[model samples]
Target: MRQDRKSLAWSTLLEIDSQPEGPLHRKLCGALRSAVVAGRVTPGSALPPSRVLAEDLGCSRWVITEAYAQLIAEGYLEARSGSATRVRATAAVPNQGQPRSNPQISVPVEFEMLPGMPDLRTFPRKRWADAVREVTASIASADLGYPDVFGHPRLRERLAAYLVRGRGAAVSADDVIVCDGTLDGVVRLCRALRSAGHTHVAVEDPGWSRLSSAVSTVGLTPVPVEVDRDGLRIDRLRANTLTRAVIVAPAHQFPTGTVLTPARRAELLHWAREVDGLVMEDDYDAEFRYDRRPIGTVQGMDSARVVLMGSLSKTLSPALRIGWVVAPPRWAEALREAAVAVTPPPVIDQLAFAAFLDAGWYDGHIRASRLRYRSRRDLLLKEMASTLPDLEISGAAAGFHLLLHLNDCDAAQAVRRAARLGLRLVDLDQYRMSARTGPPALVLGYGNLSDASVPEAVRRLAEAVRGKGTGTSCG
Candidate 1:
């Protein structure tokens, strides 16, 4: 078998060697070099012994040895005292110029305050490792095969129960479809909706751009319905007659951080029922409410007309890549069918998460995260008030971020100025589509910001807002 494989591996070399213009040894060296450079002989693959190769090629052993010596000098092959000659592990096509370095597009800032980011430092590493070890030890061999396209049965069941108890979502394990993350869930649902003949998806005006972009990527137009202090305007949704679908973060909307009022929630459901539309609810970051109980999911109001989507991105770490869609029975089969072409989250991870939920570690983590984030939010609010007394802040009741309404300063200008002073900021307009008449504001996230850094962050932000540049470097 090895001889057969080597014969196939040397086919390219044989092709190169058939041309006989140079010394036999030189030709052999050139052929070997070409094979290695073109990856016909992969790195770390053992080359046949010189005698065997020479006999196969009908060449003198002296010719083979000289060729091997030449190629080894070229840094393409290596030989040990008693082992077969092999391709060097680092051998590759030689670069013609200076090697390129990866772009630093996402390097974290000294004060990274990106909205929707969880406090990664607070991730329960020990508990998660315990869950992983337990799952790996006991997972049935049958469970390691091609996973259920929708999700692991155990994770789906645990998620369904957790959603019901915590977010008041109306769901069952059969209704759950696990995905890579919330955006992934949105993409899958959008495909299912498109398959079901839907064309337009009504999204919040200043909503999460990633989700809206996902809708458009799957060939559906994202209609930007205006959101006010009361959450999505049902009247705006009703005016858009062409849309039979909508996506919302009703529990705690991103950027704006407004909860859908009971009245609007009811109206939105009524509109969905009237138009036979489907509501894709993004339940991102609904786990942290500082002042009151987190609002119940809109799906609980009318499960048939709403599909709830959530993930561990905001609750735990986005690195986990675990998310789920709780679809109503009407759309469950369509979602499952749409998921057929996509790979679900790893079964091991799914099982570990299930064990985490079962062990109550997830709940304990959430409780601890909520308290920590609430404290950070309070500190940020207090510091901002003290430093920029005139700045009006809103959306502090829940979620990982709050909006700082700039009455006099330009939000875009402030973001640029803040960057120079080592403060990372996101303007409210980044989330806006057609509607841009709101007051200039910055969306400040305190989730990843340390409590000790809050005072300094606020100080830098104040300098930026005031158009004052302090020469102090960001440490």
Candidate 2:
């Protein structure tokens, strides 16, 4: 039985010897031929030079040369001119997920304005790195062992303090459960709600698709209530036969970027109260508002019903991988219970973040980032108006994203063309929970781009909308 190439390659290779009774070269060639036949030398592999093989075997180079010649004649090796002997081409190998040689070419324009990405360059690296090193040094080895299921206590404390001032949310460190991000925090909330007898959750129709996914991830059906400029229609909650929770982006609605009006906020609170339900407020980008005063959170007014979630992913960097779930006092224990054994945010990051806040670096960065994003946003709007004056944009007053309504245009087609041209923007319809029966649109994020990148990116985007190619990733 012939050995396999992989196995034979590992052991002693057969070689011709002295003290030959029959021709040693012939015997060596026979062994080499068998090894090659047994898949030893893999096709197209170069044989060791005769001299090297002869030295190893302590035999004449002729012996090794003759042996290699046998394999070459037996179709195991291809000795082509100007090419090292290589394994013959075979059918596709067993390797999976092998990337094709062809890849998308680099371009100067990108069409996809991907949401949820922060301007990472603005991260206070020196401060954050110093904080990380400090926290890593200060925290005990036990702290590194496993996170306290819910989250780091110090981080929760800092977050509670920060949110109380920034968003008017009343939360103690104990009421906070640190999770991976807003999505995971919402998922944790949904699991808790479902565990407590909820079967359905109300979400804004044309809502953030993620809200629906978060609701559904825990086995509950998503009851997508309608959303208008005022936000989710609270009046329709009673009509929802199964809803016990509502997920909302009150500060700046996703894709639309409209603040939930004060009147609507009150109304929704009333609806949640009436049904003995809950409101999951995703404060996605409330920190970067440019319009009216920062949108006051509904949680500050009524903490018991609102599971307010927020993350620094936009304010700082998502790579830090920290988010908070400020739950009602009643749910804290269970939320922590769920968190205790789950994937907690890394302790070092949490500690580093706590120290970062302690150092007052995050605030400074936020101030700088706010100015930068505002400039980029203004440039985007300016360039869009100059290039495509007829195009409509909404959600401009605040938030990092703008909903671009290319009137009577094909949003997906434009997105595809832009992607081919190397743009990294998303079509507005892509974020919709249900089919958008209205004007086709795209989502433009200006938060990450620089002032210079903004105008050119949007102009190229406008070009893409005009059926011209724009293939660079925006920013």
Candidate with maximal TM-score? 1
Estimate candidate 1's alpha-carbon lDDT, on a 0 to 1 scale. 0.80
Model 2, 1-475: lDDT tens digits are 3223334332266533322456777778666655555554544455554565567667886565444443443334433322233333331223234455422333545433677677766677788889988887788878978578777778888988988887888888878888777867776776678678988888777766645644543556777677777877777766876787888888888877777888898988888888888888989788878765676789998998888998877888777668888888767666766664357778898899888888888778877877777777887788888888887778847767888877777777777666656777777766565455566878887666666666667766776788854443221
Clashes of 2: 26
lDDT (Cα atoms) of all candidates against the true structure:
0.80, 0.70
Q: Candidate 2 at residue 453, lDDT?
A: 67
C-alpha positional error of residue 27 in candidate 2 after TM-score superposition, expressed in Å: 51
Q: Top lDDT: which candidate number?
A: 1
* The 10-residue segment with the lowest total lDDT in model 2: 86-95
For every model shown, the clashing-pair count is 0, 26
Q: Candidate 1, which ten residues in sequence have the lowest lDDT sum?
A: 98-107
